[model samples]
Target chain A: MDKQEEQFVKAYAPATVANVCCGFDVLGFALDAPGDEVWARKKETPGILISAVTGVEGLSADPTLNVIGVVAQKMLTDLNLEHGLELQLHKGMPVGSGLGSSAASSAAAAFAVNALLGNPFTTQELVVYAMEGERLASGSAHADNVAPSLLGGFVLVRGYDPLDVIPLGVPLDLYASVLYPQIELKTSLSRSILKQEIPLKKGIKQWGNLAGLMAGLLMKDYGLIRRSLHDEIFEPERSVLIPLFKQVKDAALKAGALGCGISGSGPSIFALSPSAEVAHDIKNAMEKVYAGSGIETKSYVSKVPEQGVRLVEQSIYQTV
Target chain B: MDKQEEQFVKAYAPATVANVCCGFDVLGFALDAPGDEVWARKKETPGILISAVTGVEGLSADPTLNVIGVVAQKMLTDLNLEHGLELQLHKGMPVGSGLGSSAASSAAAAFAVNALLGNPFTTQELVVYAMEGERLASGSAHADNVAPSLLGGFVLVRGYDPLDVIPLGVPLDLYASVLYPQIELKTSLSRSILKQEIPLKKGIKQWGNLAGLMAGLLMKDYGLIRRSLHDEIFEPERSVLIPLFKQVKDAALKAGALGCGISGSGPSIFALSPSAEVAHDIKNAMEKVYAGSGIETKSYVSKVPEQGVRLVEQSIYQTV
Candidate 1:
C-alpha cells in the first residue's frame, strides 16, 4: 500500500446512459457491460505517458489528446502528486455513440490512478476529476455520465455549483436494453440543436415526470416508472437525427418494455424492462427495425449495475 | 349510509401550501390548522341552492357563482344523480391570501356533498371535482393545492391530462411556518406576470431541485430537503410583488428555519423547520419583519397534517 510502490493497477468502468428520458442534464445510471478498462503504473518520471491504446481506431496516444491522460493528469495535479504514471486505455464501446464512451474512459483512468497511488480519495471524490475529461471531450463539464460511471446506480446531479451528486435507489428487477445505431453524431451538434428556451408548461410536465420517476424508483413501482419515462422537450427535436428512431421506439414498447427513449444526445436508444427476458426481447425487436437498412448496429442488455469503476487487477513491482 | 337519506353532513378541509418552492405547479403539502368548513344537506327540491356564505365578504350565494355550488353540481351531474343539495360555506382563512383558501373551501364542499350522498366517491376521486372549483377561483384547474387538501401529506401532481395525483411520504417531525401578508396579490395577476417561456438551464435546475426534494421526502433526509427547497424560476419574478419579501426570508433562515420562500403566488411567505420549537421561532422571526411596517400579517406554526378533508358531523333526517 506504499505510495512509492512500483505496481500496475487496472480498473474497469461501465458505460452510462445519461438524461434518462425526462431527467435531462440531471439523471443517469450505469450499465453492467460494454465498458472500458484502464491500466495505470507508477513511474519514476515526472509526467504522464500513454503506453498504448487498444480496441479502438483513430485514438491518440498523446497524453494531451486522450481522455484517460486528461483525467489522470487532473487527479495528480489536484492531489499535488509529482509522481509520474504510465497508462493504457482499452475501449469496450463505440466512441460518439452516445453511450458515454469518453465518460467510461475517464472514469476508468481516474479510478485506476487513484488505486495506483494507494487510494487517497473515496469513490465519490473521483467524480470531479472524471468530469474534467468530459469537459475536454464535449466542451462542457457534465457529471450525469461521469458520476454514474464512477459511483454506479442511478445518480441525480442535483446541482453543479457545489456538484451535488446523489446516488438514488433503483428497483431490484430493472433492466436496460440499449441500441446504438452506427452513425456519427457529435455531442456538441446534438446539444446545439436543442432550443435554449422551452415553454413553461412543458417544463412543468418534464419536472413532474422526473419527480414521478424518482418516486417510482424509491418505491419500486414499475407502473409509475413506465408512466414517467417520457421526454417532451429533448426527444421531439433530437430524435430526428437518428434514423428509424420512432420505429425502433414503437417496436420496443410493443415487446413489453416498460419505456423507451433516446439515451443521452443519442443515435443510441434505450429501453427499460421488468426482467432480463423482456430486455432481451426488447433488444431483438429494436434490432429488427434496422435490419437490412444498410447500417450496422450494436446493442447491449444489462442490469443497472450497483458498482462502477473498480480495481480489476493489481500486481506489485510489475515491470512496464 | 343511504343515498336517499335526508341528512346534513359537514366536512373540514385543511389549508395547503402549494408550489413548495422548487415544485411550482407540481407539489404541495397540507397544514394542520387554518382551514375551511362546508355543510351539505340533501334537499327535496330539484336544483342546487346555496343557503349561506359566512366568514368572508364579497362572495355570492348564487349556485353558479359560488365554488361550493359549482362543485356540487358537477359531482351530481357526473354521478348521474338527479338529487338536489343545499350547502353552506364557512371560511376559516382569509380570501386571496395565497394559502390555498379557495382550495380548502372547494375540498370541504366536495367532501361534505359526497358524504351527504352516502360517500359515493373516495377522497382521491374528489380531487377532480375540487379542481373544478379551482378553475372557477383562479381561471385554471391546477391541482397542486387541491390534491394536498384532499389527499393529505405532500402530494405531487405528476401530470394533468390524466390528472395523476400521487400522495408522497412526509417526515415525522417536519413542521411548516406560514406568514400571510394582508396585502392582496391576485393569483391571476401573479400568474400573468410570469414569463411564458424559461431558459433550459433554469428549467434543468428547477427539476433537479424537485428531484432532490422528492428524494429527500421519501428518504426523510432533512438536509436534502433544506438544500432542495429553492425556486429559481417563479420566485424571482413573483417575490417583487410581496412587500419585505427578502427580509422575511432572511429572518426565517437566520432563525434556524431549514428553508423559506413565497407560498403559492405572492404576499404569503412559508418556512419549513425541523422541529415545532424551531418552526415557532421562524414564525416569530418572520412576523417581526412586518412588525410596525403598517402591513398586517397573520402567522401560523403547525405540523404538516396527515389528514385532509374529513366528515366532521353527520345528522340524519335533519331539516335544511
Candidate 2:
C-alpha cells in the first residue's frame, strides 16, 4: 500500500443559495464569497477531534456535537480508517443567517479530510458525507445546500432515491445579490412554519413554474425566467415571517432585476439580475429599504462560483 | 373594406398525449395520426351553427352542446364579427379513451374557425379557444391537451394565469406506442378519484421528476428521460382504474422500452421507446396481455408531429 501523502490539508467550501425561486428543495447554486474554511492535520489518536473553532461564537469544541467533527468521524468510519485527525473550522459567514453556514462547514471538513487522506472519495461521495453533518444540524439529510457546496455551480437534487444530483448549466450573464439582515432565522424554525399540505390546484402551478425555470435556465430565456421565478406556495408562507418582504421584492424588481426572492428560507433575500451592474443596483436598492428599519444588513453581489470544495494547501509525503 | 377571403376552410388537429409521465397537467405532445378535422363555412345568418356532425355516431347536433359550436360562439362573440358560421364535426379518435379525443375535436374546430376568419388569432390565442372547447367536454379548461394539439410537437403548459404555453424540442429518435382498450373512462370520474391533498414528501419528488423531464427533453438524454418519466402523485391514484396496469408497464420496461404509463387518465396506455422496432415490440407485448381479457384493443405507433392545426383547404371569394 502507498503511504499517506498529505499530513495536513486546508479546503474552502463556498456558501450556497438553495431553493432558487420556484425550485423549493430541488435547486441550488454556490457563491464565490462568504464561505467557510477548514484545516485538517493528522493525529496519533484513533478518533477524530476538533481542535479549534473560529469566527462563529458559542461554537462547541466537543467533536461529538460539532458539524466538522461529526462529518469527519462518519467518513473515517465508512472508509474503515484507523488514523485520527484534527479540524480547525473558520466560519466566514454568519450562523443562523440562511447562508448555509452549517453546510459550508460540513462540506469543507469532508473535503479537507478527503484531501488529507490522499483524495480517496469522489466529490459525490463527499456530498453524502457532508449530508451526514447537515443532518446533525437540520435533523434531515437534504442535499440542496451541500450539493452545490460540493459540486459547485448550479446543482439539481433530482432524486433522493440512490442520491442522484445533476449539475445544471448557468447563463453567462447571471449575477446574484444577497442581503443578510442582522436578525437570526433558524433553518429548522423557518422550515417548521411551512405547511405540510398544499392545495392540489396550487401544485399544478408550482410544477409549471419549476419546469419553466429549468427550461429558462437551459435556454437562457430571460423573459421566461422573469415570469417563472415565482413560488406561489412556499414563498407566501415563509415571507410572512420576514418584515417588509413584499416591499423589498418590489423594489428589486423595479430596479431592472430579473427576479427576486428568498435565498434559502428567510431574512437573506437574493435578487438575480442579468448583469453584475444590475446586481449591484439591486443590492443598493435592497440596502435602502432595510436602512429605515434600524436593521443593520450586510450585502454581497457575486457570480456563481465555478468550483466547489477544493484544497487550498496540501503537503504530500512521497514514499521512497 | 376587404372582401371576405375564405368562404369555407377545412383544418386538421392532431391527437396529443397529455400529462407525459411526471408532468401532470403541465406537459404534453402531439401525434401525427388518428386526429379530428373540421370544415367551416361562413354564413349570412346571425348565429353560429353546427350544420352537420359526422364520423362519430350519436354526436349532438346542437351547436351549444358540441365542442365546435361552443368554441365558435366564444370566438365570434370575442371578435364581434357580426357574422355566423356553420361547422361540421368529424371525430376520428375514440371518445373517453384517454388519448385526448376531445382535444383533437376542439382544436380542429378552433383552428378551422380561426382560419375562416382570415387567421386573425395567433396560435397561442387559438389555444385559449381550444381550451374553451375542452371545458365543454372535460368540465375543466386545462391546456395540457389543447395546447399540444393546437401548437404541435412537445409542449409545456408553463402557466395558465396569463396563458403561457411553450413549445419544447423533441428528440429525433423518440417514438410512442398508444394502445386504446375497448373500455370507456369519463374524465370527471377519473379526476374525482384523485386525492385533494398529496403528501409533502411526494411533492418534492414529483417536482424533481418534472424538472428532470424538461431537461431530458431539451438535452435529448434518453437515459435521463427513462429515469424521469415517473409520476409519484397522480399516476398512482389514476392507474388503479385501469386493468392490469402494473403487468403492462413491467412488460414494456422488460422489452427495452424507455417508459410506460397511462396516457392521460385510463383505458389507454402509452409506452415510449427509443426505436420504432422496440415500440412495436411493446405494442405486441401489450396486445398479448390484453387479448386474454377479452377486450379488443387498437394501437398506433407514430412520431411526435411537427405541426399542430393547419388549413387543409380554403376558398376565398373577392368582390370587385
Tens-place lDDT per residue, model 2, B74-171, is 99999998879888988888888888888998899999988888789988889888888889987889899988898888888899889888888565
Off by over 4 Å in 1: A1-6, A317-320, B1-6, B317-320
Question: Which sections of candidate 2 miss by over 4 Å?
Answer: A1-7, A315-320, B1-7, B313-320
Worst 10 residues of 2 chain B by lDDT: B1-10
For candidate 2, the share of real interface contacts preserved is 0.70
Clashing pairs in 1: none
lDDT of 1 at A146: 92
- The CAPRI category of model 1 is high
Tell me the docking grade of candidate 2: medium
Interface RMSD of each: 0.6, 0.8
DockQ of each: 0.88, 0.75
Q: Positional deviation of B203 in candidate 2, in angstroms?
A: 1.3
Of candidate 2 chain A, the 10-residue stretch with the lowest lDDT total is A1-10
